[model samples]
Target: MKLIETIPENFEVQIQKITGDNFLKEKLESLGLYKGIKIKIIKNNKVDPLLVKVDNRRVSISKGLGLKIFVELL
Candidate 1:
């Protein structure tokens, strides 16, 4: 598994774990992010918010949040 922040753009991955508090987990879940969900990285330039597609919806997440999300390449 690797931090979502470190994955290259266009890579598809399945969420494995979220290393953060309940508030963070809840926040992510509200955005359609949760364990076992497949997400595709639309953009990851390292200088801008990460853009990801989840269940046909596009979501922009911060680098900090990305660091807390562990995923396996798909």
Candidate 2:
């Protein structure tokens, strides 16, 4: 149920686990990537970072960090 496993777009999930990239992890949390928060993968900018929606705000996540977060689709 990892976030990366979710489809390219159109999915909402709760963050279940986060691993690797310590600095990225902290940054994600600061941007509202807590366990209970729901997130939606808006799109993956192939040439750049992944864009996601958190608390009605858009946030860009690095590819490395995106690969480590496990999410349960809701």
Candidate 3:
């Protein structure tokens, strides 16, 4: 699995884990980010803050948080 932040833009991957404190986990879940789900890194490509597509929704996540979310490419 690779850290979400390091994954290049326009790539798709399946979420394997979300690691952090309980508060971070809860926050991610509330945003529809959990394990065994597909997500795509948007290609419009803004560094620092990243944009990820979760289901039909596009969520913006910080680099710090993205680094904690791991995924395996499909």
Candidate 4:
């Protein structure tokens, strides 16, 4: 598994785990990020927050937090 922030745009990944404490995990889960969910990288420019498609909605995730989301390429 790799960090979500490292994947290029237009790639899809399946969440394997979110590495963090319950508070962090809960925050991510509330944004539709969790194990078994499919995530698409829409934009990931180093300067700006990452843009991702989750649960059919577009969401921006910080590079710092994105690194905590572990996934496998699909």
Candidate 5:
């Protein structure tokens, strides 16, 4: 598994685990991020906010939050 922030743009990955507090987990879940879900990295330049496609919705997330999301290549 690798941190979501490290994933290259245009790559699709499966969410494996999310490491953080309940509030953080809930926040991510509300944005359509959860374990077992597949997400496509739309932008991960390391300078701007990470953009990802989840369930057909495009969501932008901070790199800090992406650090807590573990994913595997799909």
Candidate 6:
């Protein structure tokens, strides 16, 4: 399932394990995504950036990263 499909508030899901270059993984981690961490899709930004909340901080998810992140609603 896509990450954006998850309901807001008290959401938790493991990020789809992905294999990529070290640079890419580090970049993703910097955006607050890891194997066991849960993220919340706080709000949708169709034309602009996709806003998300992780570790109680708001972070923006780009279109490319959004598509790569597969998550199940829990």
Candidate-wise lDDT, in order:
0.94, 0.77, 0.85, 0.89, 0.92, 0.65
What ranges in model 4 sit over 4 Å off?
none
**Regarding lDDT, does 4 or 6 come out ahead?**
4
Cα RMSDs, all models: 0.7, 1.9, 1.7, 1.0, 0.8, 3.1
Cα-based TM-score, every candidate: 0.95, 0.80, 0.89, 0.91, 0.94, 0.66
Count of backbone clashes, every candidate in sequence = 0, 0, 0, 0, 0, 0
Cα lDDT over the full model 6:
0.65
Greater TM-score among 3 and 6 belongs to: 3
| Poorest 10 consecutive residues by lDDT, candidate 6 | 1-10
lDDT of 5 at 45: 95
Best model per lDDT: 1
* Candidate 1 lDDT by residue in tens digits, 1-74: 99999899899999999988899889999999999999999999959999999989999998888889999999
What does candidate 6 score on TM? 0.66
Candidate 4 positional error at 30, Å? 1.3
Q: In candidate 2, what are the lDDT values of residues 3-73, reduced to their tens digit?
A: 55444776777888888767877888898987778888888655667788997999887776677888888
Model 3: colliding residue pairs: none
Model 5 residue runs over 4 Å out of place are: none
Q: By TM-score, is 3 or 4 better?
A: 4
Clashing pairs in 5: none
User: Is 2 or 5 the stronger prediction by lDDT?
Assistant: 5
TM-score of 4: 0.91
Query: What would the per-residue lDDT of candidate 5 be over residues 11-63, giving only the tens digit for each residue?
Result: 99999999989998999999889999999999989589999999889999887
